[model samples]
Target: MELALIRHGQTDWNLDERVQGRTDIPLNETGREQARTAAELIRADGADWDLILSSPLQRARETAEIIAEATAVPFGGVVDGLIEQNFGEGEGMVVAEFYDRWPNRDFPGGEHDDELGARGVRTLDEIVGAHPSGTRVLAVSHGSLIRGTIARLMRTPYKQVPRLDNTSISLFAHDEDWRVVTIGGVSVAEAIPTTV
Candidate 1:
């Protein structure tokens, strides 16, 4: 199985560097353009995607719809597990301020990092299991979820996973196990250290 993971387009919260975790923000005009660009890039890659899936959040769902229209691929509906991690008290706060106030990066009542990572893995497993052996799927999700998923798949520390840009693409392949191919268009061997 092969999968392409894409971060949803930018929202106003993203522009202001505010935490948008589970806030249900919509995409800005620029974000819609970014989604179109992502579709063009995928078309240029010459891969015929079987289908596209996305988180239930408006930003991600809209992005997936745009990509599906542009690529002529079917939209496979929302996967709840693809939802962004809840930031709890950190939602709507400027990212820098939130980190400054909570240096340890823990937000009160927020979802734990381990839980997010596990969810990421489980979601991918479910997707793969539901499809045929050679299925190629495109999934639109949040930055943190994508990062956590990649970290868990690579068996690397979450902090070591590089941040993903809005609409950035990462590819993964599965045989007996999952492995990262490229992240944000950079090859894993070039951009990530596989071992701790």
Candidate 2:
């Protein structure tokens, strides 16, 4: 089975560097354009997908819709479990603002990194197990969630994982074991290069 994972395009909140966990923010004009650019790239790849899964967040949903339309995949759907990590009281707060507000604070519900990774691992296991072998799936989600999933698959510490750029494409597949064929390649930024 081959799974293609993509992080949603930039939102206004993303550009502002806000902690958008569970905020359900919609895409801005540039974000929409990024999605279109992503669609064009995927179409050019000429690969067929059997399933498409997206996080329930509006930004992710919008990206998935564009992929489904461009790829003509009929099995596009939302999976709430794939939602971004809930930032609790940090939602919509800028990163600096969050640190300032809770200089010594802990995550709400007392959740730690391990707890979050466990949940992400379980969700990914279910997503992979539900589909048959050789099924090609496209999953649209948030950066942290995708990073956590990749960390779990690699059996590595979450902190050691590489950051996935907005609209970055990752390809994972199962041979003798699950493997990440590609990582952190061709992001939304690269789609429209600007000389600055």
Candidate 3:
């Protein structure tokens, strides 16, 4: 099995550096181009994709649609499990401002960072397990979820995983064992950092 994990293209919140957890924002223009370019790169590499799984969010779905259109691949619509981690009341606020509001307090009800990481791992496990042998899945999701999934798969600390760029592709191949091909494409590799 092979998984192509892609982060959604840039959104307005991304450009503004706002906390966009659970927000259904659409992709910006640059994000569309990035998705297209990513699809082109995949096609150039001649990768045979067997399935397309995308987050329910508009941004990720939109990006996935574009990629599917470009590659002429059919998509398995909106899997809620692949959605971004919920930030509760911090949804739209700037990260710094959100921290200012919370100050020295922490959110309750398994709302901590660790809880989110665990949920992400569980979701990823379910998604990955659903595929059969030799199945290739293209998953379009948010940066945090993708990072969490990568960390879980690689057996690294969640906090240690590198930030994923918009529309970046992280490949994981499974046969007897799992392998992370390139964190992102060669060009994106230079622009972004990888955990391992």
Candidate 4:
């Protein structure tokens, strides 16, 4: 199975640098355009996806819908496990201030890193298991979730994972095990080691 994980497009919150967490923010005009650009990139990449899936959040769902429409790919319903991490009290705070207030990156009552990582991996397994071998799937999700999932798959610390840009894609392939193919359009060999 091959999977392409995409981060949702920009939102007002994203531009304001607010901690979106579980907040359901809609995409801005630029965000919609970004989705279109992402679709074009995927089309140019020449890898057809069997279906597109996304988190239930508005930003991710809308991005998926736009991509599906642009690419004529099937739209699979949202996966609950693909939802963004619950930032608890950090939601809506500016990222810089949030870090100043919580230097350890722990928000009061926020979803823990381990929990998010486990959920991300489980979601990946479920998606892969439900699809036939060689099927290509695209999933639209949040930055933290994407990064955490990749970090866990590579057996690296979450902090070591690079931040993903809006609408960026990370590709993975699974045979006996999952392996990183590319990240943010960069080949795995150029971005990071294929295996830790």
The model with the greatest lDDT is 1
lDDT score of model 4?
A: 0.89
Candidate 2 residue pairs in backbone clash: none
Query: Counting only residues 3 or more apart in sequence or on different chains, how many pairs clash (N, Cα, C under 3 Å) in candidate 4?
Result: 0
lDDT per model vs. reference: 0.91, 0.76, 0.76, 0.89
- Could you tell me the lDDT of residue 136 within candidate 4? 91
Give the per-residue lDDT digits (tens) of candidate 4, residues 1-196.
9899999999999999999999999999999999999999988888778999999999999999999999999999899889998989999999999989998777788897778888898998999888888889999999999888877887777766777899999998888887878877787666666443
Scored by TM-score, the top model is 1
Q: Which ranges of candidate 2 are over 4 A from the true structure? A: 99-106, 175-177, 186-196
Go through the candidates in order and give the C-alpha RMSD of each one to the true structure. Answer: 1.3, 5.5, 3.4, 1.6
How many clashing pairs in candidate 2? Answer: 0
Q: How far is 70's C-alpha from truth in model 4 (Å)?
A: 0.6
RMSD of 4: 1.6
> What TM-score would you give candidate 1 relative to the actual structure?
0.96
lDDT of 1 by residue, 103-143 (tens): 76678988867778899989999999988989899999999
TM-scores for all predictions: 0.96, 0.84, 0.82, 0.94
Name the runs in model 3 displaced over 4 angstroms: 96-111, 176-179, 186-196
**Candidate 2 whole-model C-alpha lDDT, 0 to 1:** 0.76
Off by over 4 Å in 1: 193-196
